[model samples]
Target chain A: MESQQATQVVLASRPATARASLENFRVETTPLPVPGAGQVLLRVDTLSLDPYMRGRMNDARSYAKPAGIGEPMPGESVATVLESHSAEFVPGDVVLAQTGWRSHVAMDAAGLKKLDVDGIEASAYLGVLGMPGFTAWSGLEVIGKPKAGETLVVGAATGPVGSLVGQLAKLAGLRAVGIAGGPKKCAYLIDVLGFDAAIDHRSPNFAQELEAACPNGIDVYFENIGGAVWNAVLPLLNQYARVPVCGLMVQQSGTLQHDTSADYLAATMRAVLTRSLQIRGYINYEFTEQYFDSFLREVGTFLREGKIKHLEDVTVGLENAPQALLNMIDGRNFGKVLVQVRSNASASRS
Target chain B: MESQQATQVVLASRPATARASLENFRVETTPLPVPGAGQVLLRVDTLSLDPYMRGRMNDARSYAKPAGIGEPMPGESVATVLESHSAEFVPGDVVLAQTGWRSHVAMDAAGLKKLDVDGIEASAYLGVLGMPGFTAWSGLEVIGKPKAGETLVVGAATGPVGSLVGQLAKLAGLRAVGIAGGPKKCAYLIDVLGFDAAIDHRSPNFAQELEAACPNGIDVYFENIGGAVWNAVLPLLNQYARVPVCGLMVQQSGTLQHDTSADYLAATMRAVLTRSLQIRGYINYEFTEQYFDSFLREVGTFLREGKIKHLEDVTVGLENAPQALLNMIDGRNFGKVLVQVRSNASASRS
Candidate 1:
């Protein structure tokens, strides 16, 4: 194998506030790692940038450990194997790996899943056919349990997770209503994604707008953006409403603004009791073993048949990953944010 | 049959504050109600006074309607059929009825459930074998899902619902930890009811005590009391913990004092997300059709075989119900609060 250079991004410092900046990340050019016994060396093609990375930057308690200072930031990526040491694969095999923000990585063969992309784009595995899509599927199918004609509301509706959640809700015969930051995303949610209604959460009368959209009250609120959006959605939730808490993008900045006058905790608890609400928080991996296969098959078929549509806001080169992630955190990204570590032109085309 | 007068207590006024005083209730002697066609006249044997009735006193939105002014305060009671106009029940049959805070009531036979004593106390139908028992059973079985050896925590440890919840958790092979307002109730929780540990919420180090008690962390929290107790239990909850919100006894007063320094709602939601928590709110009636039979059969057997014990703080007279209910709201009652409207000697022996 050629001794190539790999560009990697690492966490330089923890963010001082709720929002992280590009300064907190450091880019470095390092020698490409070699595959050891039972390992595979891969060149990352597309790196998925997600909101959960914000939590990984903080040195606080969370479901996953914080990214260490000077260490490569954790992430999932679609890659092509440059070399292999196990019977599972050989050179030129396309696979999924947790290769972080690096152009190249040496990963255990057991941790890599070889892709079966016959007529599908390899980059699709990092978005609609991957973790974000699985998160939407499991949280909605298992937790949301959207019944026919029930109003389902989701925030960040133009993003990968929220987009798929709304689509799945619509497929299950639900009245899909979406809440996005601006009119542009809202318009896309209605026109492109085929949601029943879209409310611009940035509007001054967001709560009223949400109420107007969900005339029957929200039966399943896929909670992605917390803070004001959640407050607006709370009062509109109907009896026996299910809230699958997937993300809290608004609160990730750690400087959340809340109503000081009212006891929101008591009010929330009271609402939960009186309305018989189910508020469940989950990470996708919890259901991966049981539901990932079904999710891939169903969502994969939907993608191929044009029943579902996905958009990607791609940033070229591994060095731009920090800015891409920052853009995602600020809701500037119109769709699933991806950092192109290697040009897809060099990889086998579908 | 002799025409006898009956005594009834009615809601005189709505309380302006969190605490309800005697002035809000009035006792009066009225002519006995006669059973119309398809109705049975019942002589109230024991009236069950519960925390939920506190919510009914306020003219607020809830799952059930508020108790009407100048009308009997709504409650569940064990009664004897003094006159039966329908074939479903015969005279002298003891049955469970929503007879409210009245000594005698005329009700539809269809609404009454005839008691099957068979070595069980008829009054037990109003306490351990009735609503409170069913509330504990259904919430734990359906929502809590107490797996063997999981740590279960409950507040209001000596009350009807909390007591039964702890006992049931123990029966389900869980390590039960309880929280109560004082030392005596806490003692009762540990020594009498067989909880693994009991913490006094009144203690200055209540949170610390709870943490010490739940060494393995709380996996299933049977939330009957909300407020300070909930605050302490929140941080101690384990990952993937299930909290079944059956009641909020502490918030019943409607004047809950909470800490202002922290954004508790955001913190709670953050915890919910990071820990993958499941917080579900439900009223017992929701699960009645699905799990009530299993609850009765199992808990009934436990009661008969000395596997479970119950305590009743009985007020012997129809007129004393208001004061008894007030005592219960103040946490002065150590067990299930009940008003004995008629003596056992006057009623047919079961």
Candidate 2:
């Protein structure tokens, strides 16, 4: 049999601002990598595109290392083991691997987690049953500390993390109020996702709508998108309110250039002092060691029971990843964004 | 028997900025209050002047009601019960009361906490054993979470709260670094208070000195005074650092007029996200229900064993309280500022 060719997208350039464009990525084809001893050759099935990828594009000090120029843009994917040289993984085995924006990868078996997709879809592991889902669960449980009857406010409501956060809050007996960009996302938050109230952040009277949604002030704010959403939520935060900050979607594009007249830092600190507020910033992986298994059990049960719902926006082919990522960052994608790298015949095999 | 008059200091005006002048205060003579049913007539011995009072002076919404125009400025005082109409106290009994800036007061017995001053001085309750001490204890324990061998940094080192915080950190087996305004105060922090290192904020190489002191990077920052000191400490903060923000001394005087052109607010949030930091703001009273008893027992013993030391800048008369408070706010007062409202004749009875 002739050797197969693999397509990979590499970071061509870093965006000067937070706004990323397709021009920043370059798609190239190379020979499929051969599996070495103790390694498995993966055929990428579904690639997860997240907002955090924006931070990795820039050469800045962050939780993770920057995606180097001329290298594949780093990402997690649900892949099928096309060939195996390891005792752990066999051919046709579906697994979770950090395969980046590539069609095929030869990686050590130790790096791949074999997936047991008996009753669940393989792509679900990339969204609701995966990192994004774990983010919502840990941040809410550990930092947000949802108490029954309290109101919870989350931004980017239709996204994987935000939607799951609202559902979890509702299950925990909290009043879940979601803030989304458009009327459609807002409608989905309230009608489909079971949020108590939904406010369109793009509305002219956003602050007023947010206040109306949360009759009682926000007790826990699941902060993902910062900037105007944070500004609106600051005054509405009740005494001893907890804010579990996971992502700042707005600032991920670049450093904010705000009007100089306001001293927002001083005002924020003042609120923290007077209201006894707790603001904790975190990344989900920090809790993986302690809480990952618990997350899988709890959230998996919720998903299996039809208690929590999720949505996905898929772009066909690995070459469309740059556009998919840009769309997700700009809030054009309504849910968890994924790049379908190949047909799921191998992933569906028992 | 001749009726005695009481001299009281009242809030004459609110400061337009953070700078409060003596003109904002007025001294008045009123008839000594007569104890009513379930009441106590107390002669104030030492009045505690704290930083929180500046926030109360503003008419803005906060945790507590703002000080009303022409009302005696709210404060905590250690007093001698000259007469009692309740079963809880009798003549010559020392107590803690919310008697404001008055030399004498008639208050309900429900509000007064009877003190058992054995080896500790009665005035000690107004400083090291009182609100400031509790502020340090509760903020450190509840928010700072100082672990053994971690580095703890505190501002206003010679003040009641900072001094106690450093001492407590040392006791907890953490490296304690203190920041103060002048050479004398910095010297006192290292020599008298047992801080591992002291950095003078007045020095031109303040940030460099702070970086030198905390070789391991700051793990916990007891933030009471916010301004240049906070700016210096921010860059040196380690990942997952905890900041218990009790006060913003510079902002309390007025809005911070910074020389930097960049948006500090955006920078701060970015740091919070990148570093996974925990920033919490609280007042001591918030922890009074839970941690106050633990603080009194632990710190009270530490004082007895000479494990911790305290200093007081006592002004002679009640008339000088306005000046004393101004001095404290301006960083001119060396330690905890207090007003000797009356003779210790009744206090010496214990």
Q: Return the lDDT, model 1, position B237.
A: 89
Q: What's the residue-level lDDT of B1 in candidate 2?
A: 27
DockQ of each: 0.63, 0.58
Point out the worst 10-residue segment of candidate 1 chain B by lDDT.
B252-261
Candidate 1's displacement at residue B32, Å, is 6.2
Clashing pairs in model 2, backbone N/Cα/C closer than 3 A = A17-A253, A18-A253, A18-A254, B18-B253
lDDT (Cα atoms) of all candidates against the true structure:
0.88, 0.88
Cα lDDT of model 2 by residue, A1-350, tens digit: 32388999999999887677888999999998998899999989899998779989999997589999999999999998889999998888999999999999999999899887876779989999999999999999999999999999998888899999999999999999998877888889988999999988778798899999899999999988887778788999999999998888777544323444677777788889889999999988889999999998898888778898899899988898998887777668878899998845433553
**On a 0 to 100 scale, what is the lDDT of residue B29 in model 2?**
97
C-alpha TM-score for every candidate? 0.89, 0.85
> RMSD of each candidate?
3.6, 4.3
**What docking class should model 1 receive?**
medium
The C-alpha stretches of model 1 lying farther than 4 A from their native spots are: A1-43, A51-74, A81-86, A90-92, A101-108, A254-256, A319-331, A344-350, B1-41, B52-73, B82-86, B102-106, B254-256, B344-350
List residue ranges in candidate 2 displaced over 4 A: A1-44, A51-73, A80-93, A101-107, A254-258, A318-332, A344-350, B1-43, B51-74, B81-93, B100-108, B317-332, B342-350
What lDDT tens digits, residue by residue, belong to model 2 across residues B1-350? 22399999999999987677889999999999999999999999899998778878899986589999999999999998888999988897999999999999999999998887888888889888998899999999999999999999998778889999999999999999998877888888888888999988778898899999999999999998786677788888888999999988777544333444666767777778778999999988989999889999999999888888999889979899999998877767877888998855533554
